[model samples]
Target: MHVVAHTEQPLQAHALIRAAASQPALLPLAQQLTDQCWGLLPGVHRLRFALRGDVPQNTHPASPPLTRDRLSLTLCVGPHADWPEFAEVLRAHTTGACETPVELAALQARIVTIIGAGVAGAGTARALAERGWQVTVLDAGQAPAAGASGLPVGVVAPHTSHDDSGVSRLSRAGLRLMEQTMRELLIEGVDWGCTGVRERRLPGKTRRAGVPLSWLNEHAHTANDWTHKAPPPAPDDAFWHPRGAWLKPAPLVRALLAHPNIHWQGNAKVEALRFIPHEAHLSHASTNTARWQVLQGSTVLAESSRVVLAAGPGSAALIATATEDGSAPRINPLRGQISWGLMADLPSGAHMPATPVNGHGSFVHKLASPEGPAWYTGATYDRIHGDARLLDSDHAENLERLKALEPDTAAALAPLFATVGSDAPRVHGWAGVRCGVHDRLPMMGRVPHAPEGLYMNTAMGSRGLTLALLCGELLAAQWHGEPLPVEGRLAQFLSATRFRSNA
Candidate 1:
């Protein structure tokens, strides 16, 4: 539902004419946008429209409601040389509101410091950088995605429930954003793929009730694009996700960190964070000069008027350091291991899946790797302690889960597990620890009980690839007062303060 159009002439002079000629019905909206478009600056501008329909509104909550564009229009007023800057930039300029807010005119420093170089931090850094913010990403590791996002390969798919839960809707929005980012950045087959996934629902795996409401029935066709029935041993429980994709998290993280406005500083582990107040003066009496200082012992690593803490498992301790109450949200470490091997290692006539499959555990086949074209599966989840090391017991656990997810494929690959003596396809294991909260949703927005500029984007659990990009966009949208990428109600679920409201 995205379109790209270019214009070489004076945009303001002929915008209405072009719009009016093509879609006469939208003349009024075009005129409204044109009239409010006063700043013809040499940068990016977003003019939004909230167009409501004349159709009858839904009377009850049981039936699904039909919605319209929740519209937006972007205009780049610059020369050809500046097209690249204008095209990629998305500033929260114009308020995108009916009545523009005056506060947006008076601005603070645009520099922001993001702690973490994984998908969560890099994603947020990229979102802010695209909006003209100078972003500094700090990481304890030698390079980015060294944490849980270091998973060799992962899947992106929408979550579904009988009632269409908040996580379900938010996941769909995340997948859309992920796809958009992949198209803009990363290699198609090597870094990622939109190859549809087949999900096999098994006993005690599917979350559903006895009956589905009319709301589900009404959106079935639209949902088909995201997920649809696929023929399998149990057709009723099987679903095919057209938008689903296999993603190499490290590559995407690197791409996000590659934005011109983002500067990455590795091995700069933040020991503590403190909000330093600016001294009042007669010449400059504003409170905008205050900054959050990132500290390691006595040395200050960096300082910014705005700060985002996306350090994954390291976020809780940082929040506790900065907050007055000395309390932080409960983010527990969930360790997991994924098993993989080269495709060439498999013996002749070995069963191979055409596409990725997910249910009890996920199996991604024929993905490009340093060794060769490889297949991956397993990812046993366990409570984390100290370091998350790859275990032989966990490898056995993965094989058992694979047996349930794809019995034929698991049976075929079972021999490879014992190929330790020979140079045959040997099973390799990778383990990492992912953080999560009591509620499955990610923790986003400004950190409660903390300083004004302090924010958080973490605890994505196993949905890092699926939701990280969207979380970054959501954080940037909330910061810039832009229209949310997802519904407003669904966004409230991700608020960092949802569990600590009193704080």
Candidate 2:
């Protein structure tokens, strides 16, 4: 259910949301309304009330979810004057306030097949499963997170730009959503940590991106909790992200796939998709039926009325099979490598950062590794390279990048980098290939120029840990006509159709 409430008075709205506290029967539902709605601030805000297991009675759906058992609620706060604009947004997204379109309803079957078992696939599956869809996740690997989502530890900090760019704003939304999800599904210390990230925004001469060299942001003071200037002596370009985090992507993938409504099938490498357009035997009315058979070299792996390609780079191939023009998203592979080692092996007088840091690259320490307490650094980005092999040369590249990130820390770790032999336990390397487009934003929604049931949710790049869950939620929101998790303008930036050529 989606709701838009308009009022000049926010205190009244706040009080009404808290009204659930008055009824003992409604206490459980009260816990889900946990956002600092409106912040009691002037701007528009949104709060979610998502329930599972035991749900309370509320307003019935104006438009039902893909499955009729929709248990989610979204409240969009705005003024009465904005009704025209709000209504337009609803119409553009094809939300459920009106009768479902015949074509749209055909893709709403309760069963769905999701390609890949990484963060993108698992996140999409979880969102659909919660809405009562029986989701089958197929992965080419033997286990979840066997791709880029297998990164040992990655940061989930919001992107910060001086002007609060669209990507930055979308990242904030993703981070907020992730904060709630981590609390609900995963163990705090073991699976993830809200350990704040300290970003050393270096100069443009040293890196591809950075904060303003002069260090003044007109908007920082207002959103201080999200991003702000670091304290004195911490470099004028430096930043502090209080809500940032470091997470093990694999555990998150596992947790998302664990939903009872989601079934994960490993080693099911999808080679193609066969479209079967047939006529349905309707008792009351005749209808067109659309179904997709997931194939692996003529062998059917799974069949469903809807198929979503969250298969990272592999989605390009599957989309080709269903598109009449052989059109597919041009997602490129970006490979990155990180260096890590046991903390106990550090030489005397050597030091590691007290927290995670990023700018030129990223460095994280005190994280638990299989070799015991460990520190990680680097992650040199190599574009268009699908190779994920650990290389001594790449380790050197990481150390060089880390020097630009943290000079003292890099200097201290030089000994370990210099002595890393085949059997060396002091230093190690891990590499993985991530996918992205030229714009750096992800491509999602239903695939353009393809069959109706085909969807793409890949190209997260290095921000997979930061953006995957939000992309998944956005994909679900679009399909179900639910209130979008982010603004409409920001959502449009992620659409793959933006890349389509015009005459």
Candidate 3:
């Protein structure tokens, strides 16, 4: 193995070492450096040392002594004037001696274009950039979170099934990864929370009857024993999820796209993908160097060797353009609406719950708003296309569900109900469209029989918050030939190729 280190300032070099030491992924390398008693040597110092034994003494005047079986280390001081050279050397050492796949190895220091500024696109860009790839994100809208991710608040929780099904397992894994990401990147209380969620069993719903309360409480939570005496009086048995929380999606999306290697371009909608053959570019160009031109009508938006289509519903059209057969996955638009009202609008005796309640409809308590403390509820799901307009009927439906779920709270807020959706000062809301597939699972991975560099991460449906980051990690892992963040079977389950047979 070989290791190379470089930095302009001595303090920067030490900081790099400290950072590596603290990172769980690089701690082993840090330990090796510690055992070798490596110091801040001036200029460039090359050493050959064994990992299993003591450091070897210098034997040659011009070169450091080499043990029978040892790794080589090189340290370069001063500014990195030639970044390309440094990146190549760093890539070579990190990838080891030709062990990395030829295709993945060629992608090092290359550029990748991601279309979409939503959670999926931003997450994918962040992952690729973290691996040293230059990532450019282009969106049709003027800024990030212009799609379904533009919602005011979204809940994050692992799905539960009686048999621990594939969706359940995948969601559990995704939830864990998302929680870790929030801890590392988001501000607690402001950006997100672990305040827990109360799921009320709807009337006549018996799907959870066979499941044990202890199991539900352990995996999700029945009640916060420390804070509340009993579960909310809505369901036969209200289930509590301590790990579940709500987040402001826009902030998280911005934070993910803030990476130094990621470049965000708004209003650069990609209308189509034109695959350029490797032979067309150059007679002997590497297959991995195949390029694709992203187009906006007749204009070319950008060109790159790699492209990730994560534009939600818009991804299906791009995939169709790239395919020779003009075939694309069946991505349907599911319209949803959420209703919110000021906290002061509640009747004199009516009060909001301390925690969010989820049943046929979901309710969030005391979300901080510019106007004042506000509560949000409802989110009517309808299979409608191109209907972003808010409907008073949907608002009424949401109120009905809330009345069924929490009669006390509903009765208390009766005063606001008379004026709901009539431009009432106390009542407000927003609506957006979410994309979903027939199977309810997200479509991800390389697009089959399309361009070699084309990939898709779409149809996330309502679980975008929980699944986007994990899917991005999976895509980057596959592209880099690294160990997958998810199991092989699960990755296969989410593959975009699954729909090809049907198409």
Whole-model Cα lDDT per candidate? 0.75, 0.76, 0.72
Model 3 steric clash pairs: 221-240
Instruction: Tell me the lDDT of model 2 at 267.
Output: 93
Instruction: Superpose all Cα atoms of candidate 2 onto the true structure and report the RMSD in Å to 1 decimal.
Output: 4.3
Candidate achieving the largest lDDT: 2
Q: After superposition, how far is residue 18 of candidate 1 from its true place, in Å?
A: 14
- Give the lDDT of residue 233 in candidate 1: 51
Q: List the residue pairs that clash in candidate 1.
A: none
Q: Quick one: best TM-score, which candidate?
A: 2
Task: Give the per-residue lDDT of model 2 (tens digit) for 194-293.
Answer: 8888887677633334443223443233366676677876767677887889898999999999989999999999999988776566543334566889
Ranking by TM-score: 2, 1, 3
Residue-level lDDT of model 1, residues 458-498, one tens digit each, is 99998888888788888987776554565456678988888
For candidate 3, lDDT tens digit of each residue in 1-503? 34566766534555676786886655655676554323222233333333454444344343334444445455554556633344555565555522456887765347999999999999999888976789999999998989988888888876654565577657755765676567667998887887877766665732453332434454222213211223445354676666678888888999999999999999897888999866655545555456899998889888898899999978888889998798887889888888888887776657667788775677887778777877788787888555567777777777788887777777776667668656654556688888988898888888877868899888899899888887897898677654455445667778888764635
Cand. 1 TM to true fold: 0.79
Model 1 ranges with Cα > 4 A deviation: 1-107, 209-216, 232-236, 281-288, 419-425, 501-503
TM-score for each candidate, following the candidate numbering: 0.79, 0.86, 0.76
